[model samples]
Target: MADVATKHPMEDEVKKTEASSLVGKLETDVEIKASADKFHHMFAGKPHHVSKASPGNIQGCDLHEGDWGTVGSIVFWNYVHDGEAKVAKERIEAVEPDKNLITFRVIEGDLMKEYKSFLLTIQVTPKPGGPGSIVHWHLEYEKISEEVAHPETLLQFCVEVSKEIDEHLLAEEEEVKTPETPSLVGKLETDVEIKASAEKFHHMFAGKPHHVSKASPGNIQGCDLHEGDWGQVGSIVFWNYVHDGEAKVAKERIEAVEPDKNLITFRVIDGDLMKEYKSFLLTIQVTPKLGGPGSIVHWHLEYEKISEEVAHPETLLQFCVEVSKEIDEHLLAEE
Candidate 1:
């Protein structure tokens, strides 16, 4: 976050009145403990959520033109700067998803008053042999006059905001996936009524699974992905569970996610259940209840017993019921 203008070789030339229109560049690199794709996706597709991730600095963001994540889209921001309120309007100039790069050009705001033009680009890449990524922020600008100071504050702001986002990402990755455990086989179907949004509930299980452990830590000790990313079909998830006075673990792969129908299916590939069951599959479907704000959550478990001595899945059903209730209450509290 050092002021590059003072030490840079071009310092005198940049301050010369004759070179007022000369473009000045500043760049900073930060390492964060998060997926590169996830961090890039936050700015590309979910910029509006930045306030939630860094409430102290960013107050809000609104779409002014086109759609989010699209080139040429205009976004307006309300933020705090130098202990004062400020605003900025920017247009997305470029987006390279494969390379995890996004560029924005300042179109209007306080920055325009001092600079002829300003461009901000962010690139993220995975760190080799590590669990995190490195983020690079590059700023290119031309001052309108020699009186304009270098954009040192703006560069510091970006670094601080990146740190806040990195902390949020690291917190979500704390969920632990344990080793395989014993298993059993049987079929059980039950339904519970929930006065909550079906789409929200489905999204919780699909994308924000880290929150699942937070909501029902007693029944679900932790959850982590073994293969692929969360919310994608075929992604494998390992769950640590406490059931019937015993600790258990299950490894399952997502078979389907039908957001339109509010349904998700998971088929167990290996786990504690495999010890007693030949196969196990779980499906959850949420539908809005008639004439109300509630939803009917249907839990279906299909399994083949390894032997006749295997007990039924009564306790398992109760576990699901309790977890669902806990999640319901968590969602309600947030509202």
Candidate 2:
């Protein structure tokens, strides 16, 4: 729990707490009723502080300050919903690992005027013997007026989101024979085979196929330079595609490069690849095979995902695989 002191009480009490109680009038109030369930293995332990990849009220999101995953991080959001792209900024107020409670305060945004102000805090608590964890969507508010819109509708949407997460987690847990190691320590090692180069060592990596029909966003997406100097550190690029009428974009930055070794690291900086996915990083190692050895390439990608978008990684992996196959076929035919 964060030691945040409310600037003032939920609302100003006309007289006093004792006086309000005596008069049977509540000093502070909330028009929301919320509940939760047991632990869902896939999402319960993962970090929660994130911005919707498509930030606006619309179909896409981006954070304000751009620090999407770290504590005390601030991000702005833009979304188009019902034809309106409303924007908002939020800050992570409190984080409790043992208790699984992560809170973000809406410092400024569309929700400010409705209530004197609002604090949005979410908690993933144990439900004892239940199959899924209880996600507590607690919104503390100081309303500007009695006629202000209640947060009930938003709470209702959160409920649906929790259910969706539960389903996705359950399905994923069923597919994996063993649970993934939750800690970052031992989980980094993967079974991806890296065949050693014989003489002039080469690497093998997977890249996505260009979506032929859709024109990618030239600014920050799609097989092109997105930001900064094209090949320098801090430079940015966007990879994009459209699947089933939904557009997908991944934001990445050039973190490091070793020209001598033909190596580059692309860090996911921002974009609309997944809901609540702030940053994803990929490391590509390229080397010449020598003696007509053909080059080898490898890709490593990491991202933060919302419980709802937990399954996003598999899709990206598939894209990598498909692209790899095509590259191999093309190279063989050329020879």
Candidate 3:
């Protein structure tokens, strides 16, 4: 395996220079000290139990450069075993031992055509305190065109692989969605206590945004909520509002619900919210990551759209974004 790139080496010629402005970057680092052992065990070798035989395996993702564990080796898969899928080949460019960093380049594959090239660096960097570690990822890419899919496809793969790894690590144990008992919500803010317990507060926070009464163009302005079984799955809800001063509305139907897990989802039924939008789904879930207190709230969303105008999910996504923060503040104030 090659050594990790410590310094950003300067290139003399502009042979491979980029002109496009940096679009955006998303980073999700987690300090999972308790999971260190599990990680080491699962990654000790080719995870046969995890099985790399499936299609879309991207060949050699398990191998790295220089012929070490997942290094210096290339592997391939048929994606869904549809029997007709493209092959991908990548080479491990650099590997750091102490830092647990591995960098690779997809030198051969269909992806290279549209992506030109991409640098995927994964490192398990140590956190400031104790034995904790951060799964650090750095992705630098040269887009092939304005129509190229930038981060969506890559992000989805990262998330899925993360989940799979987590699943493998916690194989023997099951996640207690809703414990037999409600975990003690340690040191909650007083306001959060009063508000969360208040009928109006729960009513406001439980469903869609009650604050926005209209959907103004380019904005999540006016909107209202309508739903059956407000917090359960199979529950249907509708939002009518104005964006940028224009009246609009989208009907939503609940597709899934895991109450014990405090998760409920809704599919957008109708709306001109985005020209590229054909459908949207929202998931509201509350997880007590800190057990008694200090819970990290994660509001997960999934969308599949067709229109270019409505493809930008930022505006519509803002509602969930704000709610997560609001919930955190409300909890802290009461703590």
Candidate 4:
């Protein structure tokens, strides 16, 4: 208090000017003619596919670090900017699939020359009273100097890319809806309630699938690992089981394991089932029950039958339900 100093009005004005001029933000919204889920998946899960959607604008995108669709992963993008070829390396800062939002921070590239920092965020929301989506693009940046221009062109580039991606997704959706011939693909799903936690239920299949045979000895006789560690993606596993009163063996590859979502997917590579179905994929997902200690276990089967005469996997789904009940009982007994 003895040496308190007051700031001058001119000083305060200059300080405010400097603070406002150092940082910038730009936002734009685009109307997308694709479903929000599909649009979000294009950027968050399969950004590499963007080049194919807009080959004239985007040359390619590749994983530089970490896996796809994960935060902290770095991706390198080669694209056209102002008719000039440019490259940008960016890190995934955030991903919120529930909200269909993804954020990226530029680490290195042509844009770094003028900006000290740059962040791009995209959020897709379903359009009200419509079948399409609304995509919002936002940019946050800090300039090296006040003379640097705002990145209006980059914002426009994002809008164009979004439209191109939406077009591609719409085309694919149409193709799926009206295939040239009768499609063999079919899906079967069932849900069962369990007296075990979702984590434990998912872990049984992801980490210790071999122990499943102990739980349902009648249905699952044994399970053995053929390659890679348990719970790892791309691992090959062999299963000996009984289906329709006959013993059957299946060799499957673990396609994906999303522990956060309590989901695992297995694709059959060799098995008696493959004889009737050209391809068979099994997905198991668990979700904790609300206001309870148990969980809901969901089994999803996706298959392409070799012919229309091949019956749907109703019996197989029944077998899964029986096995799930047995495993739930086994887990409850352990508890």
Candidate 5:
């Protein structure tokens, strides 16, 4: 006969005591004189670059498996903690670009000797009405026994490295600043294949943008002539559209019209987009597919962000793609 197990009377109480004593969490925030996006990007996408920024604390970092900025990637880090050289092997648990957060779980390291598990998270947020950011660090750990010390020294090391990185970034920004150039600028480009003639696609954007809303009713609510005449340089148009589930508007001045090349350029002069960008420029070029019955549409975006808190205009580019696809389908149906 199998023996029946019986629970001890003090088992529940002992379990509670062990849980409360072994598991702990630590958190701290440090003010930084650097852009939050840049800082977050470095850790999330380019951790190897961090060694140059804080050589004293972070000697080096290398990818052991998978690609950078991806979950389940293993990374090895060499560093100094509490005046002693140390190393850590970590796996990326999560990467949230929109939230500017990255989480690393220590899988094998010196800490594992004393702790059963350890997790580190870093999040950066832009300072309110200012030119800096705040870095928040959080640590969750479960010690093997209550006799082990809390990881306060490791948290302090993180704070010191953060300050060092901020100084390095500030220096780099100052070196690139100038009287005529914006401090931070970015560009994005994408191409789409459409079953529509290049001439019709070009004419739709350059000559008859006012009719675009009808072709892409869901993406574009409406468009109206704001200034000048259509199909001419210096003409202005206003666009109302939905982006990332929010309604937005843009007032663009026709900067260039190249009929021979089937290209058109629009520069945003005012609207909700300007609130986040110092200047935003968009260009569209369409060409007949060499070996097909349709056309190829090239979309480009160039912009300078007002601050690091503002994310790149990826959703705007996606909006352009959706509008192009819808217009292509509409044109094909008409044909």
Candidate 6:
């Protein structure tokens, strides 16, 4: 070459820093007068509904990979970013309902073009002895190059969206609360794809209760037939499960069974869960995936907590997800 290129010292240092695995982080916190559980649920389970609450900032959120409320789901967002229409594709990386924390990783879109990686985590915690909650937003990113600008505008946009969502939730709370109606019940739904036959999965939980421990022994310590034949309505089933690092037992009665629909419902009548919940019902529905050989297991929980002070059933739902995966893996191995 006729001419040799020269790099400045500062530019070389910046390149060195960018080459290393160092990530820049920013955090923002705000306090709002909305129910902490409601706020957490909106972000954790129903983010698609956020467009209705913050239409000015978020146009819509569409699920691309998995079902809502399930980890590993990919969501595409049509949003306004710095006075321009933009899209961001993110994956649900981690969800800790017990702590009201949800983390999302940006895998594509405008942010990815400027950064090597981007992660956004939102957490809500009840204020001590107060009527509101504290929401924390944290952003972790690695720039593709030193020339990329800091994400100050992105942080401001998040703050504005949070404020809008808080106001929207408060308005809904006022409209729903009345003398005739009191807040009492809460429900959670989760879906997992299993590469197994739908009929086999349904029969395992329905007619063959004793085989659960064999399939997922770590999660389900054991199961015993307490009363009528296995999988029949009015029959009783007792389960020993490891939940929240504790070994506990639960007594439930078979409420309904539909072979045509591949569904089974169990109503908790006694044991550890009853201590905190007035009633707990679990429904498992397996449906054959359209144009596929596998199945989708839909797990639904309807429960009434003893009081509003108690936490939502996030841990319980997580437990369900673990068990579902364990069973799914066991089935796949058999094939």
Instruction: List all candidate RMSDs to the true structure.
Output: 15.7, 17.8, 21.9, 13.3, 16.5, 12.5
Q: Would you list the clashing residue pairs of candidate 6?
A: none
User: Residue 5 error for model 5, in Å?
Assistant: 50
Compose the digit string of candidate 1's lDDT tens values, residues 1-335: 23322233334423333554456777777778889998898789878668878888998665656677899987778889788888888999999999888999998888899999999998888887888888888788888876888887887899888988888766645522223222333457766777788888887788877689888988898989899988889999999989998999999999999998788999989989899888888898876643347676778898887876888777898898999999999899999
What's the number of clashes in each of the models? Answer: 6, 34, 48, 0, 0, 0
lDDT scores of the candidates, listed in order = 0.80, 0.46, 0.46, 0.85, 0.83, 0.81
Error of 1 at 147 (Å): 1.1
* C-alpha-based local distance difference test score of model 5: 0.83
Cα TM-score of candidate 2: 0.40
The digit string of per-residue lDDT tens for model 3 on 189-213 reads: 1011122322222323355344433
Q: Encode model 5's per-residue lDDT on 67-118: one tens digit a residue.
A: 6779998777888888888878899999999978899999887788999999
Can you give the TM-score per candidate against the true fold? Answer: 0.49, 0.40, 0.37, 0.52, 0.49, 0.51
2 against 3, candidate with superior TM-score? 2
Clashing pairs in 4: none
Which residue segments of model 1 deviate by more than 4 Å? Answer: 1-22, 175-335
Which lDDT tens digits does candidate 2 get at residues 270-290? 666535555566665553432
Question: Model 3 — which ten-residue stretch has the worst lDDT?
Answer: 184-193
Q: In model 3, which runs have C-alpha deviations exceeding 4 angstroms?
A: 1-18, 22-26, 30-66, 70-72, 77-87, 126-132, 172-335
> Candidate 6: which stretches are off by over 4 Å?
1-64, 67-175, 180-182
**Candidate 1 residue pairs in backbone clash:** 181-272, 182-272, 182-273, 183-272, 183-273, 184-273
Pick the winner on lDDT between candidates 1 and 6: 6
Give the per-residue lDDT digits (tens) of candidate 4, residues 168-199. Answer: 99988787889553467888876677889999
